[model samples]
Target: MSGSPPRRGSALAADRAEPRAVRTRERVVRALFDALAAAPLEELTVARLCRDAGVHRVTFYGHWPDIRTLAADVFAEEVDRLARVPEDVISEAAGPAELAAAYERALRDQLREILERRDVYRTLFASGSDAGFRRRLLAAQQERAEAAVTQLARAGAEVPGRASAYPAAFIAGGVVAAFEAWAVGGATGVEAAARAITAQLPGWWPR
Candidate 1:
């Protein structure tokens, strides 16, 4: 006869396991980020990552099927750090000017964080890197842009029908390009890049 399947665990055991799992994952993620910062992604391998993470090969595999999947998660987490803005900042804005001001302030804060992780941005956005990573980054930015446009419209800003989405797409692409340029040393500084991106928005707005 075949071996019996594993038995179910108690609720208390599962509760304890959850925090341990989280801690292990966090250690692995931090190690991955450190490794990426030290070398190009193309040079990275599962064995090296597991060693650097101080995690067993099985543990790493338990959390991620492969290095690429782990990489995508790292990229997404970094992108999210730059994309999230507090809702309360714009929630109370009374007009387009106020909303724009709130948006600019929020963007500046995000840009500061981006600059702090300049090395990661430069490596990830560099030419000849994985195309899939670029697509994921772009998709994340576009999602945020769409949400921002929707919020502006809900806040009484005049978003012209059918054409409203155009602004979001344009802004998202331009912002990403500008940041990439800045990260690669093509642009002067973070503040200048942020300003340049914000300046183009009014042109894209329905007028």
Candidate 2:
């Protein structure tokens, strides 16, 4: 933030190269996107991300606790955008099936967007072997899921449970599982994958 050179950590050496600290961060994130596209997450490392972003190690550490966290932040915009559908919007639809269909449509639109940019999510998710990495990804998803469920309840959708947390957890779990499997090279068909999870909504959530 301070144009002052980054502290001498591996996260930021490359960032110091640039006069502006903000510019340095952008460079690092850009490099990460580039690297993950070409390889798997197992191959990605903090050193590599710093080098690719053209920043120093200090710069990276300054910005993220780990590469996985950074990757999640990179993909955060898309996730936030997709999760923006008003919660109550579900009730406008006639029934659970209609609501499920509508929800899936919105979800699919975003899922496709993420899938289309498969390299980033794939690479970030590929790092799922690490608990911290998976937690970061899952936490971000859970936040969005919770908010969406609240919105749905406000709109009049009957989430089976009296509270939002249960349904929210169930929905987030299903979606995250599907995406996680795909990231790890699971054989499930995309349509089938989406439907498999979406189909559960009619029964799993409040009808």
Candidate 3:
């Protein structure tokens, strides 16, 4: 049986509301980035953010519980893009040399970003107040690691007998630890750190 058609007024109102909500979120994100340029994440308050966003406190709370959650939501996408492995790097058709070069380029890109944002990285790692953002960073890296491992296995790489999640988590955790150490200690340059981190990957990993 066919369902009754929807009310035109209600459908139009719903469509309008969605765009308005998107605009509100975009404004908030812009305000947050502007605030961060002048001050650290921990220093911004809901009242100030709402004021800068030109949004009511109730509207802000409706979108995010707090500023930390908003920051995590915003920065997580950047982390995902930085950490994601290229498809060719895990494709079976790619030779070892090609895979190795592509993988190294991707790793170096992530490391360079870390170097560029070392101050923000250090703040996220060191401050308890920024734990949500740190967790978001770890989660994003873990997702990419899992994708790479899964794709590599499908491409004939020998994965461990245990669940794939275990190895992926280990790899992601190690990368996060390496970043934290580098940000906090400034022990090695980006190239050295990238090489060191890549060296620790499992033998079965592509390159």
On lDDT, the stronger of 1 and 3 is 3
Supply the global lDDT for candidate 2: 0.64
Task: Provide the TM-score for each candidate, comma-separated.
Answer: 0.71, 0.66, 0.75
Best by TM-score: 3
Number of the predicted model whose lDDT against the real structure is largest:
3
* Tens-digit lDDT track of model 3 for 1-207: 569553322112224358887798789889988998888777999899999999998777666767766776676556668766655455644554455456567778877776766666666666554447677778888887787666656666677853647888988898878777777886657788888888988776666
Tens digit per residue, CA lDDT, model 1, 12-32 = 112325887778777878887
Question: Relative to the unseen true structure, what is the Cα RMSD of model 3?
Answer: 7.2
TM-score of 1: 0.71
Stretches > 4 Å off in candidate 3: 1-18, 86-93
lDDT of 3: 0.71
Question: When superposed on Cα atoms, how far off is each prediction in RMSD?
Answer: 6.3, 5.9, 7.2
